[model samples]
Target: MGSSARVTEPQPLPWRTTRVVLWGIGLWAVALVVTLAVPALHTGDRSWWPWCCVAGIVLGLLGYSYVRRGRGNASDA
Candidate 1:
């Protein structure tokens, strides 16, 4: 007998989506703070890390707003 091949689709829930975004925001916030406090962490390069922090904060806020606006969108599906 041949084994049956089951076709399964993974579900993406609203909480999970929100959690992922929040985690990203949290990580970026931490990195930004660390980079600001510890200049040596950038290996004497002032340009890249600081800019990354700014970008991270901006993108994190954008993602947070998107997540807030899209609450329950996944569960409705």
Candidate 2:
């Protein structure tokens, strides 16, 4: 009797995750900018918009970096 090993194929990259994060960040940034530019829309809370925009930018960059790193590791493997 002979024993055989079964091989499985590698999974494909998750582009949806990357796209979602990118779009989420983009939308948030746009909203933040609009809110900041229009004082009437903010209803007297002006400071929050700038902070939100900055935070969104940082989060977006981090998400993008993570996705790229995952892709690099997958390719290396």
Candidate 3:
């Protein structure tokens, strides 16, 4: 006898992808601002902190553009 089972796919998100990416970029920007404004945050080895935030913002922008072009998702089989 063969077992009977069914598989279900997850639902897609309701929010737009660009909004999510923007939120991440905004957070990174805030972090960069705080890092720059507070001397203690980047006084020594941590001086590279601001760059991390900048990278996040830049990558988020790239992802936003990729999604906007509708090429972010893979083709369904």
Q: Between candidates 1 and 3, which one is better according to lDDT?
A: 3
**Best candidate per lDDT, number?**
3
The sequence of per-residue lDDT tens digits that candidate 3 reaches over residues 1-77 is: 58778778888888777788889989999999999999988879898898898999899899989987878765442
Extract clashing residue pairs from model 2.
none
Compared with the true structure, all predictions reach lDDT values of 0.77, 0.76, 0.86
lDDT of 2: 0.76
Clashing pairs in 1: none
lDDT of 2 by residue, 1-77 (tens): 47687778988766666687788888878988787788776666565666777788898888788886686344667
TM-score of 1: 0.67
RMSD (Cα, Å) of candidate 1? Answer: 3.4
Residue 20, model 1: Cα distance from true site in angstroms: 2.5
For candidate 1, the per-residue lDDT at 6 reads: 92
Ordered by TM-score, highest first, the candidates read 3, 1, 2
TM-score of each: 0.67, 0.57, 0.83
What is candidate 2's TM-score against the reference?
Answer: 0.57
